[model samples]
Target: MTDLILCGCGGKMGAAVRELASAREDCRIVAGVDLACQNSGLHFPVYRALSEVNEAADCIIDFSHPSTLPSILNYCRTHPGTSAILCTTGYSEEQTADIRDAAEELPLFYSRNMSLGINLLIELAKKAEAVLGDAFDVEILEMHHNQKVDAPSGTALMIADAVNEVRENNMKYAYDRHSQRKKREKNEIGMHSVRGGTIVGEHQIIFAGRHEMITLSHSAQSKELFASGAVNAALFMKGKGPGLYSMSDLI
Candidate 1:
């Protein structure tokens, strides 16, 4: 069985992962790290910090915030051969670099969205951009819960990057059109964000051609989709060596 140390165990995603892991026989959560650090009836111990944890785990599954990145990195640095699956988003450029630096030593799996469908959507968007070429206008729309701090969801940016890769990274992203009165540029990709209610997540890629429009979309019905993906990622990291892994590597 894959022994996992769940970070941010008090949060929604952490709870979801904890509940799902409890039902699976292939993996088990040995300990949890959360700021709250309350027992809350969890079988495993929850610590206010990762440094205080004594459980020896095969991998660390972090659904925590970006601020928790340092502790996770330090824990992995001290514990050689331990892997980590990071499921958080909205990391800055420097924090992203830290993740890469950690990956050079231990196995690390990271993704903006853990949903398999979202990764598939990215691939589909890339293929559409390749087939439609410059004749089509590309636009991305993303919706999230009101509690989300980031304007454009990271998944939307991921889709845009995938599409840009198809065009040799020549595409420019337009986040807002209200500041400009000029027409849309042929090489620009429009990005829009919506926040309301408890939306799990939604992303749509629009490709507008001369007379037809094609839209590729993915809707997350529940948090279980991501939780389960994290569990699977933990399992996939069991025998993995030092390297950076992604959904593309899992899927």
Candidate 2:
């Protein structure tokens, strides 16, 4: 079994990851680092910082906020032998570059969305864009809980970017719907967001044509799905080459 360390082991996603991690047979939770003590009744001791976890491990899984990057990258770079799964999202261009730099020598599976279902949808969306051609208009709608800080969720922009890569060069992200004198552009992908309820996450990609509309959606009601995917990624990254990877690699 591979020893695993979990960063952000107190948040909603962390609790979910722990619940799922407890049932796994391949990975062992050796260390847990979090800022909060609400660990959702985990068996292992959850630390308030990474330095408290004194032993080295095979891999580390991060589900914390983007602010956790500096220490994490530093940890990975210095630990040389340790690998990481970056499940945290919402990054600035500079921070992303820093992550890429860290992944230069260590194995990293960095992704905004880790659920296998969402990844499959991405593959399907790419195909739809290619087969449907320029006749269909692409629109992405995403919803998260009220506390989520990022608008249009990272996954939403990821899907829009996927479609845009195949659709056209004039693709633009439209966050609101206020204009009455405007029409949908064939090449532009409209992105929208909603914040309410305790929704775990929901994303829908629509291909609207003249006579028909095709919609593909992925609805997540709990973080268990994300936890499972993250664990799978941890398993997949073992013995893998040094480079940044996504869900596309596993799917």
Q: Which is the leading candidate under lDDT?
A: 1
- Weakest ten-residue segment in model 2 by summed lDDT: 179-188
Q: lDDT for each of the candidates?
A: 0.92, 0.84
lDDT (Cα, 0-100) at 133 in candidate 2: 78
Write one digit per residue (lDDT tens) for candidate 2, span 1-251. Answer: 77788998877888788788788889878888988775556777778877677877778899988888887777877777677899888987798898888777778888889998898888899999899978888889999999898887989988988888886655777777676468766667888889997989999999999999999999997789899888888888877767888888877
Candidate 1's clash total is: 0
The CA root-mean-square deviation of candidate 1, after full C-alpha superposition on the true structure, stands at 1.1
Q: What is the lDDT of candidate 1?
A: 0.92
TM-score of 1: 0.96
